[model samples]
Target: MKYTSYFFIFILLVAGCSDSELEPDQSIYGYEYFPLATGTYQVFEVTQTDYLNTGEVVTSDFQIRHEIAESFVSDEQETFIINRFTRANENDDWEYLNTWQSRRTEFNAIVSEENLSLLKLVFPIEAGVSWNGNSFNSLEEDTYVLDSLSFPFRLNDQGFENTITVIQADNQDFIVSLDTRFEIYAKDIGLVYKEIVNLNYCADENCLGQEIVETGIEYRQALLEYGAL
Candidate 1:
């Protein structure tokens, strides 16, 4: 009787361990950070500032909408077609602007805009992980880093429960130029915010190291609304 009881206990223990091992990990791989579905759309408020060589500053404000129009199979991989529309204000009608493509693989998420393929994010999201953003394109190597992971962020009057930021480039020469670019994506939503600041600072003897802007462009896009159509 004693031997039988011991054998039963051992069998139970082994079975319990096996069951635990078979359970899947609940860890979030962050694939939902850039969820894609047909009819899904996001609207953004875009602000562009151009600093011309003649010291003229031009600023423009508009609204742009990105909709996942359809999906197609390419080379045995699925690709999404995103239609972009723009309007000057809330009262204006949206006009077709351009078309872009996006796709996700087991390892990375890629976006092709203006015929430039950029590796936007890598899977198994973790802060500080870096990859070459231009790996799929002919552009020079551009290192993109996961600057921040899973954090709460607020933009305009909206708030996001979880968001991640990708720092595409953050290089600056205090005496000559500055080029900083970053994009933020929210959980269950795509890109929430993007900013690009490429400016040339005055390098004259009087303004050297003073960080005075000479020329370049500053562009920003902030999410205004998002939902599935």
Candidate 2:
């Protein structure tokens, strides 16, 4: 009889362990960093600087807005339509610029801009994790790394309690070229800042490492306001 009782207890313990192992993880995966909802919109202050090979520089300032205009099902997942609008200044009327698409999967988030698909972020956000940003596109493979996670970031006098930084590319050769691109996303606010600097420096022997930008573009975007329309 004691042997039978011991066997029953062993069976119960095994079943309990199996049940626990089968339970799914209910923890958050940091998807809130790129929240998507119809009518949600974010406006940004944009600055574009063009470096001419003739040694002339041109700069322009404007405002851009991205709104989740609509959504549809694609590939068995919900995809959001992003409407982009631009204006020369806060007092100017917004003009329709273009349309973009965004979607989130169980493992990653994707954004399609100008018909080019880009993997923006991965699930279970963790600092130091990296992935190929051009996995879904035909462009050359580029590694994207999560440089920071759940960190505080302040922009335009507004403070964000949780933010993440994704480093897309950071390469430079003082004598010939420079390429640096990164984006910052704030929890519940979406992308707050973006910067892209790609330039070619003078390669002459005397101008080596002189950092004279020749022909490239410097683009910056900072969040101005955001809300559900």
Candidate 3:
């Protein structure tokens, strides 16, 4: 009888341990991090800066709106949320730009933009989790490493309760020969901030002569407002 009782206690302990791990945190739901319901939308202030080989610098600032237009199912039965992108100057009307699509599965969330569908986030967000966020794009080899899954973040003077910050770069040092981008998302809100730095410079292998001329781009977008419908 003692042996049987010990066996039962062992089984109870094992069950309890696993149940704790399996239970969802209920605090960091995937949907809260990136809500995709129809009528959800966000507005951003965008700044574009460019450097020319002629030593000329050009900078422009504008506003953009991203709104969830609708939902559709693919041939494979996967559903996606369509976001309409529109842009305008400070005092001008918004001009339709393009549409982007994104969807979330049990394992990860994927967003299609700039003609490529790429993984954006993974479930059970925790620090140190890494993934190739730009695998679909062939322009440059890139990877996104999550620095803090629950980073404390503030936007528009409002503090977020939960935020995820991902650093997208070509190398581990947060630097690449081509470009690097940073994206931050908040709970129940989509991307709240983004910054992309692109560099285009040509030089010889030995780093001698003709390396004087270079061109590049710097872009930033910060969320100004958002709403969920």
Candidate 4:
């Protein structure tokens, strides 16, 4: 009798533990962070040319550090901004793109509807190759991307060339704070010229006057471009 009673109690405990009367699981959404990368093509551009320090482009490796989106407000007013920088130099070490701690920007779905076919610079924007033997991109051509920050993206021509307007869907809105160029690999495309792009959105007469903002890009070429091998 005692043995039977003990066995019955064990089964009851196991069944109770598996019942919904136990504890519930909990989870939280993880946010991401991104910062603009230092100018490397600039190194390539000024190759053999005098720059901040070295007289020539000996090693392509450099350092890049800046603040990222520490957090975000899950609303339509998606905003992001960074104010510190130092791009391998002496004079412009800790300066903003032009000024320090300058004003940032905000964004909606439709960034700019203006004649954006201009102002915006194109990556592989050279239309030609660089001194190091970069090639001119072809239609539907593909190359190894070194960077891929799609922050300042304008979906015109599917990102083939610059000077194209960005079009978004009806229901969905944009979620970036900077109005700069979205980062990506210029594979078969061209040189990475524009780091930040300003989107000018002016729809109609009422909303037609003038409203512009900045957006930064974030891409991982090390992974996407297959780094080296």
The TM-scores of all predictions, comma-separated, are 0.88, 0.89, 0.75, 0.20
Residues 1-229, model 1: lDDT tens digits = 9999999999988877866587765345788887888989999999999999998999999999999979999799899999999999999999999999999887789999969999999988899999999999997999999999889999989999999999998987667999999999999887999999999999899989999888999999999998888
Of 2 and 3, the candidate ranking higher by lDDT: 2
- Give a tens-digit lDDT track for model 4, residues 181-214: 2233233322333233323233445544344222
Name the best candidate (by TM-score). Answer: 2
Candidate RMSDs in Å, in order, are: 3.5, 3.1, 5.0, 18.7
Q: Write the per-residue lDDT of candidate 3 for residues 36-58, one digit (tens) a residue.
A: 77777888999999989888989
Let me know the TM-score candidate 3 reaches against the reference structure. 0.75
Quantify all predictions' global Cα lDDT against the true fold.
0.92, 0.92, 0.76, 0.27
Off by over 4 Å in 2: 1-27
Model 2 lDDT, full chain set: 0.92
Q: Candidate 4: list runs displaced more than 4 Å.
A: 1-66, 69-75, 90-93, 98-229
Off by over 4 Å in 1: 1-27
- Predicted candidate 2 versus true structure: per-residue lDDT over 76-147, tens digit per residue: 999999999999998999999999999999898999997999999999888999999999899898999999
Name the weakest run of 10 consecutive residues (lDDT summed) in model 4.
26-35
Clashing pairs in 3: 32-188
